[model samples]
Target: MQLKTKSRLKFTIASLLIVIFAYILSNGLIIGDYQIKSLGSITKLGLDLKGGVYIEEEIKGENISKDTIDRTKELIELRVNALGVNESVVTVTQQNRIRIEIPGVYDAENALKQIGKTGKLTFRGPNNDIVITGEDIKDASVGVNQQTNQPVVQLKLNESGTKKFAEATAKYQGKVISIYMDEELVSAPVVKSVITTGEAIIEGSKDIEEAKRLAGIIKSGALPVELVPATVKTIGPSLGADAIPTSKKAAVIGITLVMLFMAIYYRIPGIIADLALAVYIMLTMLIFTTALKATLTLPGIAGLLLSVGMAVDANVLIFERIKEELKLGKSLRSAVDAGFNRALPSILDSNITTIIAGLVLMWLGAGQVKGFALTLVTGVVCSLFTAVTVTKFLLKNFVNSNWIENKKMYGA
Candidate 1:
């Protein structure tokens, strides 16, 4: 009796803790000067969800190879990331055009300035003669100047570039060599000595971030083909404005109905399953907001709802197995253990297959499809844990407590 009392107390404490944690995470907290934003507020929304700018640029060159197109697409992605634009998508579409979607950017001109450059990097001599282009550069990175503790952009040149730079440094020993990107002067560093090692540094950046940005732009290299803007438009948030509230309402209603069904039909075990479901939702959202920093979209919400159903299904499977075990006259504890053991394989088989599909979509799909796959895979994985671990743990504790041992209460 003492052990049962302890088990009951443990279950009560654990359930309350889970509920409290979930509430805090969802609603956030504010105390005096400190504040914590809700998970939903921090989670990034995609172009469709938040509305932003869409740009289509045509590759302006004849006989553009697939490799060139691919390289340009990669550079564009790098440039966008360097601009601190998260959740942006760059894709090579039909008709030799590239499509870019940047969320939360309303100004089309600013967006163009951020990503529309051809990024042609060049080193010009004293008389404005081209010394070398970005093609001869091997790599570019940000480094610190040990003497002044200031940020600098370091450049490494290829063998040909090294020979050319060696000659230029020897000729213009004390003169300045300007670096330009798309005719815009980036830096003008004096040739201190004849550098035969192919290594150079540009030191005039205001801060480390500026130096890193310059390095990132240099590393992205020049676009293989010129890109002409085909279309640039700012997207409105009208769809998202309506979709978000509707999605929240639908989710609440659907989950409430599911919870009610489980509680009314499965009795005590149903209530435990609902608790596990809550934990699953909290865990999945935490992953999206904190761990993955994933961008939520409309399709992603669909994936989330689908995973919720799967979580409920897993609990249903276990409850039905418990009913079968009770019919065989097993004790409540034995039935609970046997039910989980019997249901685990089926649950694993279904969830694992779905996970595999989600991964494939994530690997190959683009834009909204990829978002859907990410959410689906994350939610399914979380569901597996909640169903196999959390629901089982709670049911085990309830049975051990000797609180309700009636077969009917176990859904028999």
Candidate 2:
């Protein structure tokens, strides 16, 4: 009775573990700031799956230097990304135009307006207190400070700004106030006096050119570059909307049929193999969504299906080897161990070669090719684990528990 209880406990624990693993993959995990998104939610569908706005714009100038173009592109990317856009493809074209393709974004006009806004500038005091904001900033100019005869920036603020500045300067007198442009610290000057004027002088430019650059930087921080929209168009989802549902249905049907076949052919071992295969599916989806974050393109789905088939094939190979050993009058335990050992080399060799090919494709290919390669590699690795570790665990537990004593149940 005690032995039976121990066996039941072991089996229950194993079953619970499998259930927990599956749940984790499906529901994901969140601990404080760290989070793992659910498999379906984290897997981003490509532009092919979701229609969006396509925009093309170029920097306004003749013979624009590459550095300037790069800077402009960087700023545009930063602006868009900072606005909470995800998976936005911003690429520079041959004509030096910046093309932005954002999947699932439909409002081109508002998106353009919001993305090009010159971010707010602020003055922060001790403990990161907001001393003053840029609500009343009017114009900034570069000029020579009369007293020092040095190049400086002249800033004009409205009446509201003047009052706030005067109050902050008087309150935080002798303390430091850091100036920030788009959250980047441009300057941190100590307050020397409380002036009630609306105009302020920023001194510290080494030369006229430096003063001009600083003035331009501040002005740009207040006013973003003019974006001349060359073209604004909406693209339909490259893949039809029905593609995902159809692919998912196909995957479900295929996996179900394969599991049924395994159970029918190999009997007890087949059932164990099916369990491992189920785990393989969960792990692959988790890797796809969390680890690689690979977009689920059509080719990606194909690769995943192919890998699933390979996982079944791996189980078949091991089961065949086990059957052969059992036919040679080996004990179930000996047969299982020897079969797995013999199958290991072949499985590793084939999977390793496929993984290498997938890596090569990832290195050389782009777009869907890389997606296919990524899923392919991920699937192969997961299948390797299910075939070797998961299958072994299930088989050992069944045999040790003496759930089935007949070799015939193993398809021997």
Candidate 3:
């Protein structure tokens, strides 16, 4: 029975180690033919750190209305999304100015060319009655018909539009009112009702995503003024290449120093802490890369390193408590249990406060601040798991082994 129990324990530990290893290896070292490994095993690259193109757009239009700024920002975001950059930041600054930051970019001219395109609005009748415009649109959305599960584009009209739509549709029953973008017919909703509620539905959509994009474009409305590019700065791929290596080196050095410090100060418990730390880092990377889809920027890398320091601090507190227990003549196993239980309150308090900071950063901060918030949050969570659960589990198993009788090995 004893042999079987030992074998089961060993199997469980080995399985957990394998799982931990595979998770980290899969994220850090890209496998197969075309996949490339991430530059940071835990550290991710950001746009500013990678040095992408920075474009400043000066909005010069009619009276600078808040709606205009809001609309322009949304349109630019859509355009950026269309370009397939994955992680880009577009925001409005003071004086009718817009800033776009694209990281790891090779070209800026093409983006510049696309940015200035006036998202024009047009409405044509079946007999080419160009009686209305996009300004008449109050709101638009993508929805699904509950009965058929078919996708649709819906447009809600303004007061003036409601009257106009009622008159037009009442007169031309079966005729189509075609919505165009650059002379391309996006939707042609046939006159169904008088549409007095200022709302109309465009059916015949193929999918939900396409319907949503079309709805967003229509709802963005017309630009009050033309957006001209005042400044365009393209950061080359070389810029990213230069900083990536430096950031990687920093991460390696920081984590290695942390591991060494923990081992030296805490003795055998420190080794277990180090292993848990390794697991913590890996779990953090997994959370960012898989769950949040966070773009690992250099600043983000810095935030994660800072969180690592915090994680080690938690272990240190518990270890100090264990040492105190040992001095009181407690057995090694009893010391560990008492130490963790005693330190629990302090660990929770500190981590919870930091998590509050991370939440504030994510809420109020924009662009790079979002990255910082993401890394900090992921780190705190993974660190808690490592310090509280992982270390406890490993220590419990280790204490059960027959050869582990010397209290001195535990710094007793």
Please report, in order, the local distance difference test score of every candidate based on alpha carbons.
Answer: 0.86, 0.78, 0.76
lDDT-based ranking, best first? 1, 2, 3
**Considering every candidate listed, which one attains the maximal lDDT?**
1
Work out the TM-score per prediction.
0.76, 0.65, 0.72
Task: Write the number of the candidate with greater TM-score, choosing between 2 and 3.
Answer: 3
Superposed on all Cα atoms, model 2 deviates from the true structure by an RMSD in Å of 10.2
Instruction: Residues 1-412, candidate 1: write the lDDT tens digits.
Output: 5878988998999899898888888899898999988887788887887899889989898988875677677667766666567878788876788989888778888777767675778889999999988888999888999999999999999999999999999999999998876666667889888999999888889998778767765665677678889999898988889889998998899899999999999999999999999999999999987899877889999999888888888899899999999999999988999999999999899899999999999887876788899999999999999999999988898889988777888887
lDDT of 2 by residue, 305-365 (tens): 9899888878998999999999999999899999999998888899899999999998877
Q: Pick the TM-score winner.
A: 1
Deviation in Å, model 3, residue 320 alpha carbon: 1.2
**Candidate 1, TM-score vs. the true structure?**
0.76
Native-referenced Cα lDDT, model 2: 0.78
Badly placed stretches (over 4 Å) of model 3 are 1-44, 58-70, 92-97, 120-153, 156-215, 221-231
Ranking by TM-score: 1, 3, 2
Give the poorly placed runs of model 1, Cα more than 4 Å off: 31-34, 60-75, 78-87, 91-97, 120-155, 158-196, 200-217
